[model samples]
Target: MTKKTQPKSGSEIFVPLNMLKKSPHNVRKTGHTAAEIEGLAASIAANGMLQNLVVEPERDGEGRETGHYFVTIGEGRRLAQLLRVKRRQIKKTDLIRCVLDTEHDAHEISLAENVIRLSMHPADEFDAFALLHNEKGMAADDIAARFGVTPAVVKQRLKLAAVSPALMALYREGGMSLEQVMAFTLTNDHARQQEVWQGLGWDKGADAIRRALTEGQVDADDRRARFVGPDAYLAAGGVITRDLFDDENGGYFADPGLLDRLVLSRLEQEAQAVRAEGWAWVMVTPEFDFRATSAMRRVYPSEPELSAKAQRRMEKQEAEYRELETVADNEPMTEAMKARVDRLEAEMEALRGQPVYGPADIAAGGAFVSLGYDGGVRVERGFIRKEDEAPAAQRREREPEPSEGREGSAALPERLVAQLTAQRTAALREAVASRPDIAFIAVVHAFVASTFYFGNRVSCLDVTVRTVYLSGHAAGIDESPQGRACSDRQAELAKLLPAEVEDLWDALLGFTQEQLMRLLAHCAALTFDAVVRPGSTSSPPLKHAEALSQAVSLDMAAHWQPTAANHLGRVTKAAIVEAVREGVSEEAAAQLADLKKPAMAEAAERLLADKGWLPQVLRLTQKASARMLAA
Candidate 1:
């Protein structure tokens, strides 16, 4: 190994012309303008240069230091001095006044000079924050005070600097907003950050930030779910607690599977109560997924366990109700007079059908009769209780008269079918016309296509439909010449056609009239079944582990029962009304149980309803039910 040696006090310094050359410390030009070298020369000709140059020591021609150095700073002044001496205005032998600093001190001086004079660009400000905080170890608050900016502003700039350089370029160009910048700061994931940046188009306004926030929240929640798996969460650390739940009538959930089991077990119990009571069962899980604000869906024909606990209090209430129902049933001279005469009947039933009806029995019976009157006469067990209530002129049991005109004329499935069909046809026609390349033949074909319901499938020429997305990019619209032609033509056609034309085209693309009719038939069966038992997307009695697992994993709206049932109801109705005049099959109608449960069906149904297909929905359910029964 060689021995180390200290640098010489006056070393032979040689700096390349292009490498670490010195320049004047005093700024010769303001802003971005070039220096006025000619003006400096004229000034030097009038008077010898005022300042001496600064430099590192250098060797002589023989390559010896000679205790001399070359100019490193004030180079312009030195050049001016040389020119003055050559013109005989200054003596060549004059010794220059030189001031020198160490290299470290020189660096600090360079930074200080620029800091005092330079006005920073936004990009520069952002970079400066990163350098100060990350490289120079300055505190953010300190930097903020030094820069005369808020801590938030400094923090935001640092965050902005963290964004991919490509995205920051967009921000600097005015294509992105401060709100979006703040939103982008919420995540460190690169792909998600890019996704948000592109999703917010150039024209996105301040309101777009709310949408970004929502998306960010959704992403953050998904990440949380992945990070906090249910089992791992319960394992790390937890405390079991007790609360005064209405005198300790609370429920229990045990082990990792308890939360997963809650919805199905709760629903099964709810269903049993409904069957016993002859009331419809409804289960709603509001938070269904993981929305922070989501609450459990309130079940109606509420679950016995979840409902107010039936303490002695509720038992006493039920006992009172049973007594009232009995009083109404047995003590009536006329049903209207039963309530008024209940005690009198209790007293008189022992006296062999005593006809002493009291005021109370009269009032109670009158109320019962009032509640159950079939037009005028009240019938109980197929007979009128009082001749006075139904005048002798109308005492005979009246058969439901045949409808004079149309049955439920205002709300008939057939009328709804007509309206929807017309609407769909108009939408299809408009769609075709709006596209420049869409010939009249295409429009007619589309309208004709829409007249048939496609449900989830359609065929265009030979383009067999698998999925139809309303909001999606069109194929063949890239940067190539062919793509450009197709896009420009499509745009021109859109400009030429009526605005509704695109909607009509989309309608055509979605389904044919024939498909709609079949779908309507399916809807009728599902809705009727739902009305009777309200089975979810999955078949009723959803007990299998797979089904239960799916329900829990899915969003609440994605709960198989209600969401599937709801979609079947809506789509079926739309199909039926649209194809009502097209005439659906009365034979061999299909049950709509084939659709996947715990899927996107809820979102689709909501979208369809928003587009106005409620009437068609009713008709489809009826027709499909009628067909199913016939089959």
Candidate 2:
């Protein structure tokens, strides 16, 4: 009887290609085809093999033999290497380097070798992971440790492997991430997946999806928003005046840092409206504030004009029916019925396409600023920059002739100009004087469109004001209206009032730590889970171990809130529990309290003032969580 033993003498040895055997334990499949093999061969020719192959000593019938080796691992790899050497006409003896060990424990060596090498590409790794998990039945943590990766990464990659090959290829090519792939996987419909995937590929598709994600989803009544698309409005830092719009059933503001949640809230509200009564999508932009075309409100044979058209149409239909009745004697009644249905459908289609008097058309128009949704609906209460400026040629054509005594060829009516100028001044004055509690105040210049056809069709009126603090001293700036408005607004508003111009500017910079906490209190309907170090039993609800990787993602400790969080979950859950306890699914309960809603909206509006809400959003995670969460 012979016993297997490690070769102390011939550890460094060579194995001939023919004698070496492939390992049964090896599972990674070679994706390389003939051309790839040749290219790899060429690379090896220029640079010799960099990695050593593991082998086992050959045995005889008695189970005892010389210490020379036979390959137990890297069989395909060795074959490729040998093919290259043979092509170069290199001697077999020249390939002198390989490590040999006993055959008795060959399986363990093969497993150890493969794990140590970790040479597979992502696709290969996917397969390897599948083998390790599905075939070998290893635990996720064990697999993670074996591969030096987080368990989440392993799960995510495995998740990616399950995606449709087309979508997986997009991920492999860096078009999407594991989370995105995971999201895509939730939609079971192959056609829907394809639709969404292709839609994402379009130049505007991603923007649209992003808008939907950020705004929550549009519903019937809310769909017809008073702004260009929600994406654009939110981008512009839409300060939703939720408080002022209430009758009893509706009206509430979205919390700062909760645009997506707010959108969802709004959608649910609109959906309730639809259930109560039918509603349609209304996209309001600075240019147009209602659907350009709506079927519900017909324009063709306008409602006012429909009765006469209906009578005439009925007469035509009756005549056609009579003719069909005559033909029915020769043909099937089904044919006549089919023909009638087709004719009616065509008429309906034509009528549906015609324009109607939308909310925008019915609403009064002026220089008042307004919010528009879907690039067509405007929420006019104040000034709204027009979506479409009159083309230069059109504007020039519309210009009035110059006054006889004016130096310029054309002059504005002094009366009209003076009136507008005075109106702007008064607005500015009102804005400035309203703040008395604060120490200082200022009015920056305001920009307004003038009927003036001259250079720079805009006029600016800038003013600065200040008040003493506890000491009879004051401070304010007038560099630009922006700077001036900010300094003065802060001076007047104090903490109780909504952020003045300056507070809005700061909020745009990002939610301060305190502000994020305040937002969590205000927007309590969303849910999120919290994760912490396994051993950290005493950690603060909001704080985490500084050394752990989780804390690294959340760098600003004081201002720690979830960044890039897209859904409501535990972190949200914790926030709701800690701040507000209304059920996440209950929109009405989640709606800000009547007294608190205005203050929250004011804070949010100020937060959105200058830069809009997007910059503030960028600071938050796409996934909401405490400091302990990580993707």
lDDT of 2 by residue, 490-568 (tens): 3222222221222332332343445433332222211121333356564554232333324346433242322223212
lDDT of 1 by residue, 1-631 (tens): 9886635533434333222223434333452212334335454554444544455555569977545544555556555555556667666556566654445344445445446665655766787789989999988787765544567667777876786676677778887665655555545555766765555433244334333434312221232222233344345442111111111221111222333243234334434543343222222221111121111111011112322343444455456656767876776445655554565445333333322322222222211111111112111111112322223223234467678545555466887867877898788768856874444344344433332222212334332222122112322113224333432443332222221222445543455555434433332322222222234464453334334334334222221222234344345533432322222222212221232222223323333332333332133334344554565
Among these predicted structures, which one has the highest lDDT? 2
Per-candidate TM-scores read 0.22, 0.25
Error of 1 at 36 (Å): 39
True-structure RMSD, every candidate: 30.3, 26.8
lDDT (0-100) at residue 245 of candidate 2? 18
lDDT of 2: 0.41
Top candidate, metric TM-score: 2
Q: Against the unseen true structure, what C-alpha lDDT does each candidate score?
A: 0.40, 0.41
